[model samples]
Target: MGVIEDLADALARDVLEAQAELGDDRFYEKMSKVLGELSPTTQEAFMTSVRVRLAEKRGRDFLARMLAAKRSGGAAPQAPRGPDSGH
Candidate 1:
């Protein structure tokens, strides 16, 4: 895989591991809070990236929960990869 792919894989693995340790509810929260804070266009990119990451992590419910959280509040923490967050 290329650099971007590797980064995605690594991040996905980390998310997966974190989710396994933290459970779906918490994991979803962290992811949602983190990504949702971005600008609309960035939110789209982040969501897309997150979907790819979650696909690698096999966190299907996590993704659903994030979407739900996008409408509501689910505790998704801002990951360092985001914009305006020194990511």
Candidate 2:
């Protein structure tokens, strides 16, 4: 990821962590206050960066799933049956 995307990711993680620490009751207010403090351009850039990162992550996940399915001969994997699973 480029510098902008990297920074955006870090910022996002920080915001989420803060929200978790503050709990659901204050999450929205804290997020709104932080977002409100940002310049419009910065906010736009941050959003764009975050979107790009998400796309990349999803793309990677898709590729991994595809590879796993291919390795299993293009069939969906079956879960192992246990003694209690009724086979």
Pick the TM-score winner: 2
lDDT of 1 at 36: 55
Q: Across residues 46-79, which tens digit of lDDT does each residue of candidate 1 receive?
A: 4456677656555666666677878786676443
Work out the TM-score per prediction. 0.34, 0.51
Candidate 2 residue-wise lDDT, 1-87, digit = tens: 766556656775565456657766345344544665865544555666455655676677777877899898886545446689887
- Write down the TM-score for model 1: 0.34
**Candidate 1 local Cα displacement, residue 47, angstroms:** 2.4
Scored against the true structure, residue 27 in model 1 reaches a CA lDDT of 69
Candidate 2: minimum summed lDDT over ten consecutive residues — where?
A: 24-33
